[model samples]
Target: MPPDSDGVPNKTRRDFLKKSSFLTAAAFVPVTVVNAAVNQWDEKLASVFEKTSLHLEVNGLALNLSVEPRTTLLDLLREQLNLTGTKKGCDRGQCGACTVHADGMRINSCLSLAVTNEGKKITTIEGLSKGQELHPMQEAFIKHDGFQCGYCTPGQIMSAVALIKEGHAGSEMEIREYMSGNICRCGAYPNIVNAIQEVKTGGLS
Candidate 1:
């Protein structure tokens, strides 16, 4: 910038930068407007074809649901079927608090697509009881105090039940390794393992 007669700069770099920023923002205004408009159009188009139907057995009850194809199994269970036992920890499948049994196998319900669960038997924590009688795993957890906050208890019990049914609950190390996916943030792992071991080895004492 040219200096004035007083030997002072007429305009500093900060002033130039402010002007340049305004010009740059003005130039990008049209692009921003167009992008927002296109996004709105894309969202509308995507929502248009999202409606879909799925049939699955949840908690021993047959359910035929009409939902968006993008709906996850967790949402289907919690939002649609009112089964809130499955907690949503990390929706990206990193956490296993949303674990459930599908077709007798444990899977992260958050990552499972509702549309793909058709004709599959889905078992949640709510299904692990007969009337008022608790399942063996449930009883074991209660007896052993397997959980502290109890947020992860449902998924843990679900996974443990499936493992017991599959005869995978042999050794303590084996149970820990198998149950690694279901994390207990409260560090109640020892007691949780003890509960599963008791239910598996017929030694609840």
Candidate 2:
């Protein structure tokens, strides 16, 4: 009954007793009820929320898509658009196997959220060719045997194209430094570098 600093009756013991009683009651609740409540809450959220609409162009095709906010560009391309040439190697942006071009700049699609790329242009490996005519970089890679196992070819090609566009393919050292993000486990670094050099020198605009 004693008043505390807030000029209210001290209810510490009362609060503790109330909490204890509630907890004791909760302890007797069946696990099924708790699980059902959680499931119902999740279902309600899903039913109430709407998927985000993303307007973007991929491989010269304008796409209007509905996706969850959590969807990544990699998933949008590979899972939804069926552009599986962009390999999901590490999926952490470390191996660079999921690399793609967003608005003419190289990016790790795996780490880039699809919602963030709304209204942007995306280019995957599948976009690099026109009918039977391959992009110069793609041709160079094939000629140079730039990949073995071929898991990282897509990312390596994308990065290489961007490297030449960015004017970073001046030398072998520079190419290696810039293209270091794309890792090839097949020990084809030399061939990869050669392919990039050929493309750079070939003047492919």
Candidate 3:
């Protein structure tokens, strides 16, 4: 022990020796053991926060991807897979601009999680066409001028295709009701309905 300025003993030397010995022992530990401990901790954390695998078919192409749990189907399509045809109008799933076909059913991709769509067949606007030939609905839209700015055309076409397939496009009123979810800011509702009606009457789908 050492005396302070007042001649009173401070901490004893045994305490200092004990701390020094502990530090020295810690310093002498093997680097391999330290690295192993760190690796074990990292692996434990990785196991808890591991990314999930999603296997699905997109636009006729089979894909096996790893995605975080929070990744939405719209983001996975537009961002990860580079499929930009599916527009991201209202990411809250209101405007229906991110519509896509999943397992033959029309789905709001913005609201569907990528993980939930595992093993499902996804079809976007790009998948509607075969090679260089345009789908009949595409041709009908072009003929009827169903869009102005074309921002919502992809979602509209996707929904129209699904509506025709599901036998919901029986009349103009039915088309309007089914397509009400897709909001075209350009106000091309009449032309869009005409295009869908023509395709439905012609049995082009």
What C-alpha lDDT do the candidate models reach, one value each?
0.82, 0.85, 0.85
Candidate 1 regions exceeding 4 Å error are 1-49, 203-205
lDDT by residue (tens digit), candidate 2, 22-110: 45545777764466455654344443343677899999999998888788999989999999999998889899999999999999999
Give RMSD to native, each candidate: 16.3, 10.6, 15.9
Q: What digit string (tens of lDDT, one per residue) describes model 1 on residues 28-137?
A: 77775466455654345444444566789988888877878778999999998899999999898776899999998999999998988878999999987889988888
Runs off by more than 4 Å, candidate 2: 1-41, 44-48, 203-205
lDDT of 2: 0.85
lDDT of 1: 0.82
TM-score list, all predictions? 0.76, 0.79, 0.76
Residue 139, candidate 3: C-alpha displacement in angstroms? 0.7
TM-score, structure 3 vs. true: 0.76
Tens digit per residue, CA lDDT, model 3, 154-204: 999999999989998888888899898899999999999999998888845
Q: Distance (Å) between predicted and true CA of 106, model 3? A: 0.5
Give me candidate 2's TM-score against the actual structure: 0.79
